[model samples]
Target: MTTIHNGVSPRAHAVQAAAALAASMGIGRFVYTPILPLMHTQSGLSASLGATLATANYVGYLIGALAGILIPGVVRSAAVMRTSLVVLIATLALMPTTHDGSIWFALRLVAGIASALVFMIAVSALHAHLRGQSQFLAGWGFGGVGLGIALSGVLVFVVRFIGSWGTAWLASASLAVVCAVAAWGLTPEPRPIITPDAPGTPSSHRWFTALVISYFLEGIGYIIAGTFLVAAIDLAALQWVGSGAWIVVGLAAFPSCALWAWLSLRWSRPTLLLVALLIQAVGIALPAVIGGVGPALISAFLFGVTFLGIGSIALAIGAHLQFPRAVALLTAGYSVGQILGPLVVTPLLRDGYRDALLLGAAVVLGAAVAAAVLRFRFPSDLDADPRTATSTEEVVFDVR
Candidate 1:
């Protein structure tokens, strides 16, 4: 008989967690990218304002991440997740009801906070319940973000022909409602029994600092593409091409974490991290350097394949270091990088998205360089706990 926890099977819990991720991350946070073009054309939102809005959302995400780290109780509470889901849906629904830019900014900001909370709670649940299960199950759960992205992209793509940006937001809200229902039964991670650990040699700060710098750079570079890829593609490609490419990105991302996780079993993570970042840099620059329907789609695929995987590898590396509050520190650095991404590129946006994308690619290459530094004399065997051997694999399977 299948073991049940609080009336939900482990498989069922994973499914629910996936649904929650799809709702909060895929639809709640990312639907903005596809809808951005519509707002530009129909709502008359300026490029600078759009960048500001994106920044606001990132700021909110940082706040939410910090909250989870500081409170501890929040990540363990089902009520927090439920409330965040409701708030997320509310933000999406209210977004279409106003033409005021400040309101839009506030809504996106709240949505960001809610997205972070939902994401943390869902991930915690997975880590708690899915222990000892096949790592593939966790990968699939993380892929929920990609699934949500694809669904929202399809919704916006169809709405482009028939409705305004408002309609797109409303439709996305409805889709989120469906996902929320599916995820409603998800259980929060139960609190763990506390135990002390054996003392060990201190981790090398030099390598850890290199890893932080690389991951921080990754945050800046990836968010630029994440926020503007569709818009950038729309500039040079056909009308359908932009949204179509986003769909491709989502589809490619859906299986990417699982693929990366499986590969880590064979290759060292630092090697894989460098490889992923280098490929992502190429993907980010492809559309800018070579504009065409083909290049856009190829660019989308490459980006989708690596962005989440990079986060997985970087966090796993942090865990291996066993730095104090490593996950929180890395997450904070990443969140700050995300907030800075759009602002750094705002001046470039005045011309078009091309210059911004080129800059983003350059930053990612910088991150790859840092990753290269980390690989030199990396302490892959730093953690002597045999029980923690799978830590790298577990972290790699999770989406950021």
Candidate 2:
């Protein structure tokens, strides 16, 4: 029962926790992208099964996000953080070992739940400590997911170079191990703020509904581009360019998250979010609709730049809604979005990407319109509570 509501702050400790959480949640995501084709060729997995595993992971994340809404949490809850990280680390290490598609799916579901707990609780911690710091404190915590994305990409590249999926799993697990140690000693100070509810608070919840729809749609739109961006490149007969394109997306994402967060300081969160969503929608549809490496690479770049801002913008908007339950509601809506994205797109995988990109484009445009409504109607820091919806959906995705 250490109270940090009005005492010595734990800003540094909060940041550390957030970084660790981000790293754990980012497990194997980068590796999953570029190496998926290789995995299918070498590991003898089917495309459908691969899709199932992804579905399971996102399903797990969705469940975890819903649980976060009801879970009683306090900032600097070391026990909660440690337990969540342990679950995430174990899943990362064990995920590659499960050959049975069903079992792998279950593990991913559990891992997603664990990750949601760690992510939300850590944000609770940062938001608590940063009550006195500028608005950007939560933004930095949110940005940790971007850094984690970068680190995960590097780990994947090294593992791909070494030629063992096991090595990548091991390396990521080791990183989690180190993070656990660092985060364990952090001050266990609880922030004690109440997050938003799922069905409660009419005005806030209505906007929450719109935001959730946008987020879920972003999930659909982004994942199609994410899952097949690499394959699409290879299909177009530009393997090297496609690979290079992903690297560029990852590169831009690392800094663009910070840049977007900074932009939130100067402009409306909803405006920036709308622009980013539209840019990504166009990027997503470009590969299928356009020809050659030039459009492909450009699509990748725009995808990278616009995508890095989404979670930040969404979470920042949640902060603006100002209802008591805004953060949790925001998270739940985002999780719902992530779950629906893959499910909706999974069936259309065989229809070529025309359906996929068009669906995605439609959804992203929907998100943009919702963002507009949000900016104009509710444009203030009403729900400035601290929390991380970064993992509420895919924070940073490079080409799949």
Candidate number achieving the greatest TM-score relative to the actual structure: 1
Per-residue lDDT, model 2, residue 379, is 39
Local distance difference test values of all predictions, in order:
0.86, 0.62
| TM-score for each model | 0.95, 0.80
Error of 2 at 190 (Å): 0.9
Instruction: Candidate 1: give the clashing pairs.
Output: none
Q: Runs in model 2 with CA error above 4 Å? A: 1-11, 28-31, 74-76, 188-209, 226-231, 234-247, 291-300, 322-324, 351-355, 375-400
lDDT score at residue 298, model 1, on the 0-100 scale: 99
Among residues 3 or more apart in sequence or in different chains, the pairs in candidate 2 whose N, CA or C atoms overlap within 3 Å are 75-191, 195-325, 196-325, 216-337, 320-382, 322-382, 322-383
Choose the strongest candidate by lDDT.
1
**Candidate 2 TM-score to native:** 0.80
RMSD per prediction, one decimal?
2.7, 5.5
Q: Write the per-residue lDDT of candidate 2 for residues 82-167, one digit (tens) a residue.
A: 78778778877886686677777777777777776666565555554554555545555555555565566566556666666566
